[model samples]
Target: MTRIVRRLRAVAALPLLVGACSASAVFADEAATTTSTTSTSAADDVAPSTLERDVHLFVIQKDGSVEEHDDSTLRANTTSGVDDIAQRYVWFNKDIEHVDLLKAETIDRDGVAHPVGSEAIRDVQEPRSAGAPTFEDGVLRTVIFPGVEPGARVHLVFRKTRTKPLQAGAFAYLVEPTRGPVELQQLIFDLPDDLPLYADARGYTALPPVTANGRTRYTFEYRHGTYAPIEAGAVGYATWGDRLMVSTVPDFATFAAQYRSAAADPTANDPTVTSLAQSLTAGLTEPADKARVLYDWMRFNIRYVALFLGETAAVPHKVVDILRNRYGDCKDHVALYGALLAAVGIRSEAALLNLGPFYTLPAVPGYGASAINHVIVWIPELHLFADTTAGGIAFGTLPTGVMDRPVLLDGDGTLARTPAVQPRGRTTRLQIDVDASGTGTFAYRVEDSGAPAELERNVFRRATHRQAQQIAADRLRQTGLHGTAHVSTSDVAATRGPFATTLQGTLEHFTWPDGTTALPALTSFAGGLATQVQAWLAEPERTQPWVCIGGDFDETAEIALPDTLRVTDLPTDTAVRDGFFDYASHYVFDPATHVLQITRRLTAQFGHQVCTPDQFAQMRGTLQRIERDALSQVVVKAGRM
Candidate 1:
């Protein structure tokens, strides 16, 4: 249950009630139809078994309670091959839901069905680390069928009953489409006619509801003869593709009101909060500066520990508890930060943000909490959204995940979008000096601003100096160079401007062995830019639109050749521009000084992270050009310049 909640917290755009059911569990149960056969080779032994049928049914009661049932049938068909369908497990919160296993059995090729013994079922508590809260409410039930082998089929059926609604009189459920090959896949919802239900079918069509026994049933079904896997580099299929959302809640405004009610008391007038806020901003004259002081203090001091149990999922911890513990989840951070801001005479609202691959909200009309998993403070006066849970984010900037996404303002009950924060252009400057022996010494200064700068700060915060040096060296080696490196950074904890890191390293085999004519190895400049570009372009024919979270990158490298080497040729300069992205590279060779200078910049001005197939083609071309430019070499000859 905790695992399901965690996943829901990450990618959920509707509400946890809608997204908690496990689709993989159903898929695992459906792999029993393939007939047993002898494997032709070892390669065939490890191939994934196919699922025959995956089905789920949700019976929604008039009182808003839901009973979810899943049944899957599958087969193991090859001799001496892995039976991927035999394993089965179900996670449920004992306090909020009841799980009942109706059937678990194995059917042999000869049509003999053997029921699994009760002894095969086991219950266990998931392990937890120290300092992490023990969610004692959840339990995992495992069922192992006997005599599961090639030529045998495995079938499993289970039902879960939610004792109460996540919110009073509000019911929601989501069914995600199966990923692998399947003969039949379906999702059926049985609802009482009296209940108000809003349904959205994304990436698939929803059939009209059928009414019987004073109830209306909504059905969604799909049949894939062969596996249709999502494209490589795609955000999860659930994040962008087929799924069904059903909710009893009416609209976004009502949903916003529910959230506002949970976070009703801001604790602005508390004596302790007032004292701390005063102390934190005593000498700051400007309102923005004072806000920054408060924001930074909360960002560094509060530890983020997510506790999304039954009721606590929606209700934030009390301000007093958050302050005393000095650690809380995103909502808790918002509580403390909001209180401090109010104490300092700055008005702010708690804004709900859905952080992850999801950017646009579903066009479905309903008030569901599944889509929002994080809370941040929105300063109306400054027109700024501050995410204190993002430890080192700049005061005025929002994290990449939250920026440009729809946010629900708490008190106003209004759904609004956060402004996009474009990259200020993180820059890396490199200087390399090579000796006659082909060994080189290098120095690098990296200036990172905006979200990139925040990421750099987190890296420095978690790693020691030696560890940072090793990380830098490993990054340098990715460019096809071998070396040892050292790293130093500006005071990242206190500074708000562009964070900088200075790195020094020694490179081996800096020059290629071509007898008299030598070539300088191309540097893999600026944090895997070439690798990222190649990966983005790996799949040429893309069905789904490409999503590029906004960012900008720049790299400049100056290589000083040894006096014995003279420049002969250089890689061509190139430029590419499009609505989604821009790339430019320039090179200069000085014959007298034996130096080669290269500058490259890549910027993604994608206001909206989504790109159409045509836009993706343009972006792919730009990235390819950038990769070619980054890998270009400097040709040189053995002679005094």
Candidate 2:
């Protein structure tokens, strides 16, 4: 797939400070310079396959269009590596970008070259872009290499020409190291002598610029001769390793201003938009309340459609068209919602954002199409960031995915960050009563806020009745119980309050009156402690930074025994307070009533979304302690006759 098409399709799959800071100043402070690692010994430590040679050439014209060429060679050392590099997919936009396959060949271990004929190359539409409105310039060129096996090398060369700039007269590009080891990689930029370039090379060695024949050339080299093991739960590699970011635009302010000019009020002087806005917010007086109403209206009414056809990549459709069709992508949602807010006398700026996995923005200023892929509205009057594209998310709650990331506000040309609200955690209360027949009836309720709340709320809302029942049955089974359960949940549509769900059930063989019986794992429903403990234990030793968003989980359970039974033992109480994590479990047995009460609370409130290995280690120890405590069960026996 083409780089841009792959990037755009990646939207279906899965920020920087600006202001006053010149491009040079930003790069000087945040960019890290590194020397190339030419030795292959370090790469051997983790190499399953190696990138023998990777090169990219970009020629930027004075009119802001780009001509790009790429050449890459991959050598597979193992069978799995062959599978990983066997087939190549080149993606491009049929409308705005022109692509040509320059070469496709495979070299066998015996040094025999097999060139791929035209029959080996297949051109097709991107699967995600097959539908009607979603169909755009997405085209995939699949090249199947011949004689690809372990110790064989596959090579490909392709060129793409962008007839128009992503923006009107600006170009931006970013490249990062692959997950596997790389022997040599080069990124070269050919720019018109008069077009100043802002570039940041982090972990890549930047060579001196050469100017000749009315053009200036910039090159960045990267080499990692040693295998770099990828750790699970680690932040994006762009944050920790090699990256080359370049933009013809001088600063974020310039990029934002240019975008604002191109994306100018699509709703201006549109009476239908104004009328609808008036109808929606007629009764709401407060700006926050009005914003909420309009945001919800868009979420419920407008269907999200990914349309990358033509200039739509950098521009949004007219507000009227979006309203008439009742469907739009993130940018469309922002356009219509912002226009509606405007009609209601509430001002909102369209905030450009990188809704991708990474949290921080590169130091170099970049156009929205390359660096920032999503848009939301910023209500400066209320100092709130609203993402209307999130259908199930509450009005005030930003999905954890976009929290704390940098934003480039249109019109204002300033950079800001979304708030990283501390998670409200999850709480559950469970009560069980055992009769003489060894049957137990229980009532369970769980409530949560923040990201957990958003997730749980959507899960039940989207589930069919049968699916929900299966979920309940699975939860019960996970806790080592067989039962008939009926579940009732609060209305997840209510955006102002915590989300809650209650499960009531009857289970057989809950306990034995005459013999010792082990306690069940009660918190096995949504956000259960036992489940969390197991997950933490699964990854005890983390090599990378952990994504430890702050949160707490609290559960309380009361078990009432029959008059014929007596409790002989209960788990001991334990309290653990560690860095970024606090946990406590308490057991109280009322002998006079034959009731056992248990309370467990775990709080993990890290300062940031990314936590250090040391912090995770401490949290891991705390979870281990909680797991051991959870293993303790109540010992019960028949009452003395």
Candidate 3:
């Protein structure tokens, strides 16, 4: 696991002024800077500005309650001429801080570079012994937590100093800890002490009239004056973090050497770990084999407990306690695995990767040691990246959809380009090719090799006969198709690996307009996930960056009437690919056999934002088109003889 640098990458909408402006002019006249009033050149306010910055974060756990932590930080430099924006954002909640070359560099707003000119000590209100804070290169960085007493306050005070006067379009960022589900809380911006108020937030509500916990304090604002523009909808947010990313250790040879060295030292022998190694030593054939055996043992034995914290999460717990106890959350799981492997002659390091089940990267925000939430063992041998949090998962595959996000650990951590965040196994699409005759013969087969047996399990687990009757049928009912579904039996051939589950069912009086057939034209792509589609249409347009983009299906049905009704209409056999839409719908009709086949595939991982009015209208119409294509009773004027 390599330690990565701080990062920031994309945006769906530009919330700045209509045109670009030069940031240097916002504060070019040093003589004019003496006044407390805001600067002139409102034009420069909307244009992107180059900046050099540093931030210090402190986390305190108050003592009573906690859930699951997903937080960390990032430092990145973006150049767009005078539109350059080089900023460092530290994202750390409780568990994060992977180290590497601490020396960092920066270039300022006027294209000039600078280094941190000062470093000093500041006592946090924590009880734990803090680390020696320092400033090296251009970074004024520190990792410290004077432990917190039970029922005490958790205070995180972060300070940021920049190279130029803060103006319009100039963003000063400081992120907050994400516990679980995020709520929209009021934000207070920090205006210059001497200068009267200057800027306000866009898209979000104004500062609150009341404060809940006076301790929850931190905010950013543009220095108001000539250069600042009071714009609406151009807001800033301190959002959540992505999930942990693990890989097979790519450098197995080096890891093995490190492990052997760590194990030979008498001082490094931990009693609890030594005992466990003894217990499992019989299974070990070689150093790497022992490391793998140890890794597998942790995955199978340990259970994931949901314990959320703010700062203690940053501190890696002693692995000795975790393995002996046999239970822990994301962080503990990694520490225990790393410790066990290290003791037995397999090198294991505590590297932080973003947790995937929560948010994503590049699109949302980037996290370094400061923002990492979960922990995992880096098995450099065999290039294995393991996350013990997911129990029962096989040796090579990760549990579900965490993959491709920039992993910031020890090596490969200094790259400037953030890795593209992709939901690993989501590439495995769920394809149900069912052949329904008298009794529907449903087939569960994956189109892509990435599609695992888990996808089938997830589908069959929810596709209960009763559930299908209620939701699936209700959705079909909305399509003007009448039917009652009874799932006779649903059996998954293999749950341990890639295998299919056969879903055979009985649907009586299933009818569209013509009285007999059901076609692929009647798709559940939208109607099936009507609720999800609605949410996608309504609010929270995009999921967190680390979040996977895949649709969970309810049911896919194909019916053959008593060989009577003829196929009528079909969905548009067309698909359009745009940055915001990946959609295709097709309907096949064989009038000779009175069978209508419908195939609908929707790829809606467009930008995190929702569809525009035009997009939404088109989307809503596509549903109607599919329904209409699936509808339409086959017309046949028969004579009553």
Worst 10 residues of 2 by lDDT: 7-16
Across 430-454, the per-residue lDDT of candidate 1 in tens digits comes to: 8999888878898988788776777
Ranking by lDDT: 2, 1, 3
Best by lDDT: 2
The whole-model lDDT of each prediction reads: 0.66, 0.71, 0.34
lDDT of 2 by residue, 146-222 (tens): 88898999888989887865566666665655556677888778888787677666666777788999988878787
Best by TM-score: 2
lDDT of each residue in 43-155, candidate 3, tens digit only: 44222221122122211122211111112221122223211112222322222222222333333324333332223122122222122111011222343222222211112
- Pairs of colliding residues, candidate 2: 1-89, 1-90, 1-91, 2-90, 2-91, 15-361, 42-226, 43-225, 43-226, 43-227
Least accurate stretch of 10 residues (summed lDDT) in model 3? 11-20
* Reference-based lDDT, residue 538, model 3: 42
For candidate 1, what is the TM-score? 0.84
Per-prediction TM-score to the true structure, in the order listed = 0.84, 0.88, 0.45
lDDT of 2 at 235: 57
Off by over 4 Å in 2: 4-46, 128-135, 226-228, 266-268, 306-312, 367-370, 434-439, 480-484, 508-516, 521-526, 533-538, 541-543, 562-566, 617-623, 630-632, 636-641
- How many steric clashes does model 3 contain? 67
